[model samples]
Target: MPIYQAPVRDTLFVLNEVLGYERYTNLPGFSDASGDVLEAILAEGARLAENVILPTNRVGDMEGCVRHDDGSVTTPKGFKEAYRQYCEGGWMGLAAPVEHGGQGLPYAVHTAVAEYMVSANLALLMYPGLTQGAIAAILTHGTDEQKTAFVPKMVEGVWTGTMNLTEPHCGTDLGLLRTKAVPNGDGTYKISGQKIFISAGEHDMADNIVHLVLARIEGAPEGVKGISLFIVPKLKLDAAGNPGERNTLSCGSIEEKMGIHGNSTCVMNYDEAEGALLGEPNGGLRAMFTMMNEARLGVGLQGLSQSEVAYQNAVAYAKDRLQGRSLTGVKAPEKKADPIIVHPDIRRSLMTMRAFNEAGRAFTLWTALKSDVAHRSGDDSDRQAADDHMSLMTPIVKGVLTDKGFEHAVMAQQVFGGHGYIEEHGMSQFVRDARIAMIYEGANGIQALDLVGRKLGANGGRAVQAFFKEVGEFCEENRADEKMAPYTKALKKGLNDLQAATMWLMQNGMKNPDNAGAASTDFLHLFGLVALGYMWAQMAKTAQGKLADGANGSTSFYDNKLVTGRYFMERVMPETAAHLARLSSGAETMMALPAEAF
Candidate 1:
């Protein structure tokens, strides 16, 4: 069976050392996450992930989710129990506001723990993951009554939540959605629509489900301008605020998907379900985006989580599986063959996954810190800067991490040879599971377009310009440090490539919109490479500092960190040039073919 061990120590390295998480203690929740407290939380989270959640992964995939004749859904075996334990442990609201029953910790701390949970069993985690997004939406955009009725229960994990936006005909285009809502004489409306591909849509784990539905009101304008968000619960609330009457909504059917079988991806049908408007009328897209943005970040972490678990298993397999004699000589003559890890090609794959996972973790935590700053900072300028960082990086995180996450899973699977393809080894499951992250929460292509078409130019390019300045300053600051030379040099090159790509898009994209469309993905990837390269440079600097300070007898860990960072700088950062080249070539050839040519 495939095994997973959360890299708690590596997470500490990123949090305590690389990101200097303690420096932000002045923030609202950061003060609560003292080093010792953070360590204890991660240790406990790792224990749960390893001891409880990891064991259920293969079983969940094997069992999947089942839908009954009554329009109710059952998650894979052990899921309900696992979820109960999760709630009892107070994990569901690790970072939620204290007024709403959470621990009131920094979002960075929550994100760090979430990585472990996701790596343990993504399918199981989705139940609460979607709920967190819903809680965020209601907290951000919902009215006082809506927040009072929904946020506490969802945060407590008694009531899971989902975002219902897609219909049978509409996925990304909200304007095409046909879901309708009509005033029901009171404040609530009667919602009638069908939404497809809703994860954790109907499940037995929670007492209720709060659905944030998007629909158009009667006599509302056509297209997206008419859309409005609604809070439609599975069970209507009583005057005392408990689930009372059944809502007119049911799971029509569950989707048979490529992976994450343990998650109930349902087709939901609403027959005049009672729902309250979440925000202003005709402002549904704006409100729902609050959930979508959070979900996108969570999905990005999902990519990293899968890659981390897959890498762990692949490394274990490579170390144990004996294949051929070492190229150097008979290193393991007593065993008749050396371990496959002795092979250069196998080492190459393992190193690549390792490099990406470590830097990816840093990248994620960095962004999570920005999120905390954006939401919690008292200064308007600080909030704006942090928000800009979020808007700029979210797409890259969702797009690049997932695209690479799936790539690494496949690579990890390849290390097992044909054994990886079979069901027994469980490598296949990782490959299958990681595939969805690239496609969901606004497909990677759409994420790329968002990065290029919207984010890059927002606020007169303030965010992108700030990012360039920060990275350039880092490179310049470290130019004289010999130990940091390798990482800084490579990162500088990658940053330059990213800057050139941005310039190319600005110069050529407006002249031919297709140029922007064709170049967006590459540009996003180029941005991701530089961003990760920046992570490696920072990590290298920190590791070198620790080593110089004697590393407190943990020299090996710091040494290994430097080595992995060097590998990324040498082998991976160079890919930025390729992305830059492809993007600069732009639209002419890509859009040359006629419509019927294929």
Candidate 2:
């Protein structure tokens, strides 16, 4: 069986040391997350993931979710019990507001714990993952009565939540949405439509399911402006605010998917379901984005989680499976052949995954910290700057992490050779599961387009410019430190390429829109390389500082960290040059071919 162990030590290193997680104690939730408290939470989360969650992964994949004739969906065995335990642990409300019955801890802490759980069993955790996103949306945009009626139970995990936006004909274009809503003559509206590919839409794990549905109100407008969001529960609440009557909605069927079968992706059919307006009419798109952004970040983490677990299993396999003799010498004469780990090629693959996973963790936490500051800070300027960071990094995080994440999973699978391809080893499941992250939560291609077309030029390029300044200043600040020169120099080169690409887009893309379209993905990746390179440089600096301070008896840990960071700088950061070159070449040859020619 494949195995997974949460990287607790590395996560703490990124949080406490590199990210300065304690420096923000002034924030509302940060004060509660003391070093000791943070460690305890992670330790407990790791135990749950390794012991309770990891065991269910393959079983969930093999058994999948089942849909009955009555439209009730049953998850794989042990899922209901695991979910109950997860809720009882108060994990669902770790970072939620205290007013809403959450522990009110820092979001960074929640994110760290979330990584462990996701790495253990992504399909299972997704049930609550979607709930968390719904909580965020309702908290941000819901009315006081709405919060009272819904947020508490949802946070307690007694109920779950889902976002319903896609229809049979429309996936990306909201203007094409046909779901309609008409006034019910009371305060509510009648929502009637079919939504497809809704994850966690119908399940027996929770007592109730709250759905945030997007539909066009009667005669609101012609396109997206006509859209409105609604709070539609699977079971309508009674006067006592408990589930009373079955709502006019049902799971039509579960979609046969390539992966994440444990998550019931349902085709939902609504017949005049009673729903309340979530926000102002004609403002549904704006309200729904709150949940969408959170989901996008979570989806990015999913990619990293898969890569981490796959890398762990691959490393274990490589160290035990004996193969060809080492080219250097016979180090293991007792065995018939040396372990495959002794081979340079195997080492290369392992090192690559290691390098990406560590830096990827840092990048994710860094962004999560930004989210904390944006939401918790009292000062307007501080909040704006933090929000700007989120706006700029979300796409890069979603696109780059997922794109590389899937590639690394494939590479780790390659280490197992034929054994990896077969189902017995479970590497194929990792590959299949990781595949969806790249396509969902705004496909990587769309993420790239958003980065290039909307985000870069927003606010007169304030976010991108601020990003460049931060990285450039970091490079300048560390130029004189000999130990930091390797990482800083490589990061500086990558940053320069990103800047050049940005400039090229500004100069040429405006004249020819197709040029921007062709360059979008490359530009987003180039941006991602620099962002991760920045992460590596910061981590390298932290590792050097700790080592100079004696590392508190962790010499090996700090030493290995430096080695991995250096590997990323040498092998991975240079790819930015290729992205820059390709993007600068423009869309001429690429777009010259006619569509019919193929």
Candidate 3:
């Protein structure tokens, strides 16, 4: 079985020391999340993740979810029980609104707990995770009656939710969607469509599955503008708001996927299923963006979570697996050979994983804080600024984290040599699971396109300008400190690299649109490296302060953090220059090849 400790201490350090989360207590819902309260919440969450969910991971993977002939889906053994425990703990509404039966904590707290659940078992997490996103959508766009009828139950985990957008003919191009919603004379619509690759689509875990689907109403304008959102339930509601009649929907089949077998990815068929319009007529895409953005960030977390677990297992294996003698000397002369960890190459792999994981954790949490500010702040300007910053960082968080996450997972697997290749050891499962994060949630490519194409120009470049100003201010503020100079200097260089790439895009992309397309991915990654570099610099400053305060009796922890931050600054941050170079090269070479040449 695989081991998963939730890194609760590390998370607490980020919360208390690095970000100074207590400072935000004046914000709505955060006053109750003081240090002690946060610690207690995380401790219990960690216990649940390690003791309950971790045990079921391999079992869920091997046995998978079974769909019966009657279209009822049964998850692997112990999954329902674990979910029951989760719901009983009030975890489903950890960060939801208080009026909707939620704890009403800040998004930052929700993000921390979710990282634990995802790290323990991603497939199991998806059931509630998707539900949370759906709640966000309905809360943002649903009617008062809709909110009264649905949000509370979802918040209490009595029902789950899903976002149904994909179809047999379309994935990224919502304009090509063919689903239809014809308005019945009363108020409801008759939805007829087939949605493919719907995660947690047909699970038997909850009493109701509220599918927030996108369909075009009759006589609406063509393309994406015509699309409308709907609330299509698995079971129709009774007069008293209980699940009453069966809806005209069924799971056509569950996909035999390469990974996440524990999750029920279904091909759903809706033959005039009774549906009610959500939001407004021809306003589905706008509302659905709410759920998609939430899921995208969660997907990015999935990448980091998989890397963390894979790295943990790999580190343990490296310390125990005997390979060859060290090149420097026979450190373990008593044995025939030293452990693989003693080798320089293995250290490189481990350091790569460590540096990325630590920085990525901080980066994601930082974004979550922005989410809190966007949603809870009293100042309208502050909320708008935070929202813009979040929009700017979303793609980078989703694109770079997942891209590096998969790469790190493969590197960790390589550390185990042949043993990692076998399924019994569980390293391969991490690799397979990590692979999907890069492809879903708008795919990394589309994320890059959004970053370069839409986000950069949004609000006259307010967010990017603010980002540059923020990082520049940090660099300037710490430049004179002897202990922090290295990180500051390295981050300054990365910022310069990112700025140069931005300037290059601005100069070239206007002349040739393909230049932007060709350079967007590299540009997003370049931006991401600098973003993480900023995170490492902040963490380094925190560690430096702690060390200057005599380490507070935790010398090794602070020392290791400083060393890892330095490693990231010295090694990982330099990669931004290469990405800048590639992006600056533009479409000249990339687009030169003829279609027939390949």
TM-score of each: 0.99, 0.99, 0.99
Instruction: Summarize candidate 1's per-residue lDDT along 1-598 as a digit string, tens digits.
Output: 8898889999999999999998898899887878898899999999998888888899899999999999988788888888999998999999999998998899898899999999999999999999999999999988788888889988899999999999999899889998899999999999999999999999999999999999999999999999999999999999999999999999999999999999999999999999999999999989988999999999999999999999999999999999998888877878978999999999999999999999999999999999999999998999999999999999999999999999999999999999999998999899999999999899999999999999999989999999999999999998999989999999989998999999999999999999999999999999999999999999999999999999999999999999999999999999999999999998999988899997
Worst 10 residues of 2 by lDDT: 29-38
Model 3 whole-model lDDT (C-alpha atoms): 0.93
Q: Candidate 3's residue-wise lDDT over 60-100, tens digit each? A: 88999999999999999999999999999999999999999
RMSD in order of candidates? 0.8, 0.7, 0.8
lDDT of each: 0.94, 0.93, 0.93
Error of 1 at 75 (Å): 1.3
What shift in Å separates residue 87 of candidate 1 from its native position after superposition? 0.6
Candidate 2's C-alpha runs over 4 A off are none
Candidate 1 segments exceeding 4 Å error: none
Residues 326-430, candidate 2: write the lDDT tens digits.
Answer: 999986999999999999999999999999999999999999999999999998999999999999999999998899889999999999999999999999999
Q: Quick one: RMSD of model 2?
A: 0.7
TM-score of 2: 0.99
The alpha-carbon lDDT assigned to residue 525 of candidate 2 equals 88
The residue pairs that clash in candidate 3, if any, are: none
